[model samples]
Target: MVISMAAASAPTTEYVNMYTLNLFSLAGGTTTSSTANRMVIEFGRGNGVVLNGSFTYGADGALSGGTLTGFEEYYAGVKGFDVLGASVPVLDFANLINANDFEGVLNAIFGGIDSISGSPMSDYLNGMAGPDTLSGLDGDDYLDGSAGDDVILGGNGADSVRGLEDNDTIEGGAGDDDVNGNMGIDLVHGGAGNDTVRGGQGNDVIYGDAGDDGHVNGNLGDDQVFGGVGADTLYGGQGADVLRGDEDNDWLSGDLGNDVLYGGAGADRFLFRAGSGVDVVGDFNYAAGDRVQLAPGTAYSLTTVGADAVINLGVGDQIILTGTGAAGAEWVVFA
Candidate 1:
């Protein structure tokens, strides 16, 4: 025997000998033992249940031995399930069950949950269990790739992003920005404006799209930097700045002005036209074996050196000459 109690208004009785009974469209009501021999009670919309006696299921497949009271006045829709004698509604177990089942009945009750249309202003933050795709529909927003190889975008505004703990890809769009890949191998791009980027703890790739940009302390790992257009500063903080005197190299200029350059490691080349007062300074170990190729009719002087082949140039002078004998080579004025 199976019995279910539901809240309904008025005491109504129906007799059925079957083990299973499906009750529908009930208000709030109570059932006495004499009311039925076996029972199945189903709570309809806006229904509540209050059981007064111990319930037992009979071998004949009927719900038996329970008294249900306080059918109508005890249950209310907006207030949830009210207590048997209290006017104020308290936290009820009924609401928990209803809320838990709300998701299961969503398709039948209201067709289906609809997608949000028009502009979206919220940023999506996703967790490790997701191989997730998030869109920053149309706002200055922030998206996080918490874990799992993720992709993030700064839709607009000067946005910032940190790839917390995975190999992630991030793009900053249409604004001055900062991007950091906190762990794992990552790829980052500064979409526009003066942007600052760092590959926190991995062999990372960063690009400065436009405007003056700065890179600091991007440790270990072979990294690549391109200062795209405008006067940009590139610091191969611990590695080499692959100096290609292309259209984007800010240090490769040919006008007569005091300039400073450091080739921290590896062979750093300084290419200049005549009249560019380029100064190269560093310890003998870092300055040695680096070449400064000079153009015709350029005036330069190598004023100080820690060793015979090591030299530092004072302000308003240039280092000229390249080849095997170039280091510690004396500067001569060409008329």
Candidate 2:
């Protein structure tokens, strides 16, 4: 049964009547008491009412669930609810929740915005006001959650997407396409294409999948990056990071902080500068044409320890390139 309530922003002074209900009571249970299981607060305002509550299930207890309401905090169908202050995503069907971005799979189960957890609600999703989550299933489609915290998934095909505000997650499917996290903490996956991806603000995680010449930038955030195939360029901006150039020729640099870099295959370039924290490069193959580029006017010394090459650039700061034999001796090139 759907017990209703007013959205928190609704003024309670004008509410006619409010109901405190137990989940089992909706099925006509005995009475209202503390041990009555789940307790629901129904805020009835204007022409409708809506519900929001928290509950724990006892073997003989009740379970509480949130309800749908208009932006004005009324159970007035789907006029669409735009939350005030912070945010709560109006993602799929019926399940209009607040202050929480439920993370699971995008099962589009709603006729429009607002969803119950784990239901595939939409084939294509458009972002609404407030923190919204949108997902795409099994096709090349477009997704743009206009504002707030959003989650976008391009399950397959060449797709275009944008997360305009708050923390977001965007996954681009098999086809080459564009995906951008405009604000907040974001996680992006470029699946199998020469894709261009950028993390606009806050902390972000980016992955470049198999394809020729992919470009990725960790604009803000202590990001983690993986270049999964072909020639790729990865930049770690203003944060401690881990960069793995996996497969084929790649170019990588640890722009700031202590970082770990891996030149996985073919010829690769690992760059560093003075004042940047000590960074390490895993799997630096000298025979594969991998080279370490140092900033101009930087003074440094090189040595080998048990197949590992270390560069000491004064002030006890150093860069260790591991996983190579003495052939790595010739791998260092100052830029």
Q: Pick the candidate with the highest TM-score.
A: 2
Cα lDDT over the full model 1: 0.41
**Model 1 / residue 67 / CA error / Å:** 34
Give per-residue CA lDDT, model 2, range 164-248, as digits (tens).
6888878776777677777788888877777777776777888887786456777677888878887888877778888888888
TM-score of each: 0.41, 0.56
Each model's lDDT comes to 0.41, 0.58
What lDDT is reached at residue 78 by model 1? 21
In terms of lDDT, the poorest run of 10 residues in model 2 is: 16-25
Q: lDDT score, residue 104, model 2?
A: 13
Scored against the true structure, residue 301 in model 1 reaches a CA lDDT of: 53
